[model samples]
Target: MTKFILTAFNPANGQRARLHYDNATSELTSESGESLVQAVEVVARANAPAVSKQTPLAKSSPRVLKISLGLSCNYACEYCSQRFVPRADETNPGDVQAFVDGLDSWVTSPPEKVEFWGGEPLVYIKTMRPLAEAIRSKFPNAELSVITNGSLLNDEINDWLDRMGFSVGISHDGPGQPVRGPDPLQDPEQRAAIMALYARLAPQRRISFNAMVNRENASRAAIQRFFIELTGDPAVPIGEGSFVDAYDEGGIAHSLRPGELHAYRNLAFHEIRTGQAANVQAVSSKTASFVNSIRSRRPASSLGQKCGMDKTESIAVDLRGNVLTCQNVSAASTAPNGQPHHIGHVSDLAAVKLNTATHWSKRENCPSCPMLQICQGSCMFLEGPLWDRSCDNAFSDAVPIFAAGIEFLTGLVPFHIEGELRDDRKDIFGFSEQVKPSRDRPPRVFPIPVVAA
Candidate 1:
């Protein structure tokens, strides 16, 4: 017998209600109250035809093991928070061993996804190879992925990923040259090499791109054109756009002018809408019709937010062994006191609690937002007192981009709903508009003011 789980949030009492349905006799029962069964029966009879089990939606896993392979990077992107560059002295065998050992224990207990992030993950391919090999051998079921600038990926690294069965996410900001520090546009050779590598790896690997949109590169027409060409295939998932505040440890590197911000929003929306339309066309006509209907009926506000790097869904570890709550947090602060204290091991429930608590406390403003579930309050490091002074800038910039994405995908939903929803579909877009201008807000910067040691 098939089962359907029904879950509803009771706004009046701030509680959750769960009900289960049995497909055989079309019976329903509430898991909590004694009268729940009667209520379910009444609803079941009223609805008739079918009864499905009420399974609670699986909460996202908060366990993310970020193995920071060291603070080494090849490209000098202007907005890079880590200020990363390839440094031989930074890589420590002892640190790597401790991290791997800690990860092994973490997987044994709660079992979480492992993400390799860094100045650039490919810098330590040797360390990564063995680590990936070990994790796949031991944890078989644990999800593994990597976030790299893609400047250093070669055939060997691609092969390693393919053999180990890992997903890959590459970072690039289309084409704009904001002088990183001194070197203008990241090495031209490096960029070309990355593109070549992507082309070669695209067919076999689950590859995605992350473009950090900012004022310098926010040309909507250019961005839309680039995305159209990049994700021409409907089957392939489109890349993501993240609005980045231009700055590093030094100070504000650049800020988006009001005009640039408006243009960027329009471009992002266009990309999303066009991308969805193309994807729907690739599917059966019957499905496309359904998508149109849904698009017409659904309120723009009703569309959900895109799934991003959430604390509950993922976390990051620094070059030392400090496990951070998320990537943005990892990027904002160097190991506290530069000692690299272990925040929490991957397998440790303590880590989950610390990360979750840190995330919740940092996201105090989120509880009131309409798009809380979708935004998950965005990156804490980007919000709060950590980096940007404005609480709403992150999501404010994100909403236009995210909403466009939702319109695009929902526009195509008619075609793919009957079949299994692709994992990529969950990456929808929706953002709230309750944002205050940074200039008008009180400054609450993080890495709290410390006297020079």
Candidate 2:
């Protein structure tokens, strides 16, 4: 079993621990101080499950299915995940009936959740309505969800959505509107329609204002406050709080800049701790999972991709029946790793082979990363500069949660990571000076700190 030293601090009481950690089988064997012994009970009770069982693509049946309408969208957000993806053949409302007929045979069992996708799903209102209607009829109890930019919503559309029992997510970067290209909130008609839909769905837990963090829109607390003020609801739920995946030039421009990683993590950790960003799922969920991993001693090998696209049972397909790599990419697109994103068609599930993705285990750095459980390998198919930029963003995004989780479990926030990982990654949240060499081994002088871009 590989062993490493981890240094952390408890923000609550400013207590510190230099703990011994096992990598091959995850466990915190001991701490420098005897005072932490009782508080370590949290680790024993966490008991997080291993990653989902893997199955061959040909034999798997998905419980979570995403249907892609098309790549068509109304607004051009600078950092949209799909901005650079290649477009596939467009499917129209006419394709819905055929798509519905195929599902009975294609889907081995009823999906628990069916997501309607598009560049802006509402942009294909014609196709979306009929397709959603068919899916609802087939899987009557399934959770139907859609994410739209609020520009197209109206009384008629909102009423239809309510009747259909859909959980809607409206995409808006509240305070960072200019970077996102347009503000649907600025238009009087769109604003009214958005409020109307919000009024209709708020009580049912069926609506949320989806937001993403980028260099320009870095503050979750600020984002939350803006939404709360705009909606006049103090307890508004926010979705998609993770950092933006850098896809192209536009995406690169918005990704975290050099030396900003430490600042971002500090801000994020403070916001999460103060409950200012409690509505953000990315913060709350990651913090919980990270804490449980430590408590349960979950190994790095048990971790899966951040997006479950590597799982055979998490499927994405178009009305034309072509199964795709994931919802963020289209069938016509090719992954940066030089593989086509389209795996196979639903008509021939047995022949399908998902060659597009590389699991976290396959990534060169993932296994050694202290943030493996948190970052989980950003974007399975991204490669080259895109992958590099995304990995940078993931590192900064996860460090705060990493520190918070450790603080919760052992009252020690990890200021630095030391062991099998690269020398550069050992410093957590840019706190390189805090790392002290083990007394048993001679200390090797480290180079000057290089800020991650």
Range of the 10 consecutive residues with the lowest summed lDDT in candidate 2: 44-53
Model 1 TM: 0.57
Q: Give Cα-based local distance difference scores for all models.
A: 0.43, 0.78
lDDT (10s digit) by residue, model 2, range 1-453: 246678665455544457776654556545553333232343223322222113224426778999998998988888888887889888998898998988877688898999999888998999998888888988898999999998999998999999999999999877887788899999999999999999899998899999989988988989999999989988787888999988888888888887777778778877776788888878888988876666666666666678876666778998899988888788889876676788888888888777777676766777677677788888877778888889889988997777676667666566777788767566766754754535464434343222222
Worst 10 residues of 1 by lDDT: 48-57
As a whole number from 0 to 100, the lDDT of residue 180 in candidate 1 is: 32
Which is the leading candidate under lDDT?
A: 2
**Residue 442 error, candidate 1, Å:** 42
Q: Highest TM-score: which candidate? A: 2
lDDT of 1 at 44: 15
